[model samples]
Target: AQSVTQPDIHITVSEGASLELRCNYSYGATPYLFWYVQSPGQGLQLLLKYFSGDTLVQGIKGFEAEFKRSQSSFNLRKPSVHWSDAAEYFCAVGYLSYNTDKLIFGTGTRLQVFP
Candidate 1:
């Protein structure tokens, strides 16, 4: 079965520090990869996605992800961190099952931004 994995369960970064959250996926063919952010008491927000065309895709809130086919990774990155950035980040991959679309999400990586 196809699945997504976020190795780091938690990460701490100071304000204005560069951040990178690792994400890996297992799929036979190309999958639709997405990065979503969730803050306390808030719904999930789509950061970015990559299906084809470009390997590197820009996302909202100064975020970006690069899809590396060889590494099967779609890692999220930000040049600087903000206190508001503290939240749970999820990596999801879209799968087509019996004509139905499905999204498999990782356990999630909790980001803690210090001021």
Candidate 2:
């Protein structure tokens, strides 16, 4: 069985500060990993994905993540977060064996920015 879990329900960070969001998954084999961001009442936009190759992947909006196979974790990180970066982050796993390219998403992590 494949599943994803985000331990942090919500997080608050000051503008221009570094940020980190946790993500953990359970899967039988190596799965395609992705991180998406969604603003209030908006659709999700792909930040980045790790299919193979590099363990650390860079993403848009000054974000990056490192995939740790041993730990079963893919944690997102940002050197300096902007106020506009405040949104809901979801970690997802894509199963190629499935009929459709559907993603199994984590509960979600809400990011709050303080000016």
Candidate 3:
């Protein structure tokens, strides 16, 4: 079965500190990987995605992720955390075989930025 797991249910970081969110996936072949951020009552916004090519991919909102095939991981990272960055982060996997663009999201990791 194809699925994604976010090990950390929640994470807290001081403002201006570095941040990293763990993500692991189980899928056959190279599945499309995505990181999305959602504020309360807001829709999911694409942070980054790995389809093919370079292992490292850059994304919006000063976010980046490295796709490690061996580890089956696509971890999200940021140099400095901001209070506004506090939100729910989700790791998602998209099926290539299915035409539907639906995404399977992880339970999610809540980020709390402390001043």
Error of 1 at 79 (Å): 0.4
Residue pairs with clashing backbones, model 3: none
- Give the per-residue lDDT digits (tens) of candidate 3, residues 1-115: 9899999999999999999999999998778999999999999888999899999999998999999989999999999988999999999998855666767889999999999
What 10-residue stretch in candidate 1 is worst by lDDT? Answer: 94-103
Which residue pairs come into collision in candidate 1?
A: none
Question: Candidate 2 at residue 115, lDDT?
Answer: 94
Q: Tell me the TM-score of each prediction against the true structure.
A: 0.96, 0.97, 0.95
- Candidate 2 error regions (>4 Å): none
Residue 80, model 1, lDDT: 94
What lDDT, from 0 to 1, does candidate 1 have? Answer: 0.96
Summarize candidate 1's per-residue lDDT along 5-66 as a digit string, tens digits.
Answer: 99999999999999999999999888999999999989999999888998999999999999
1-115, model 2: which lDDT tens digit per residue? Answer: 8999999999999999999999999988888999999999999999999999999999999999999999999999999989999999999998875566878999999999999
* Model 2 quality (TM-score): 0.97
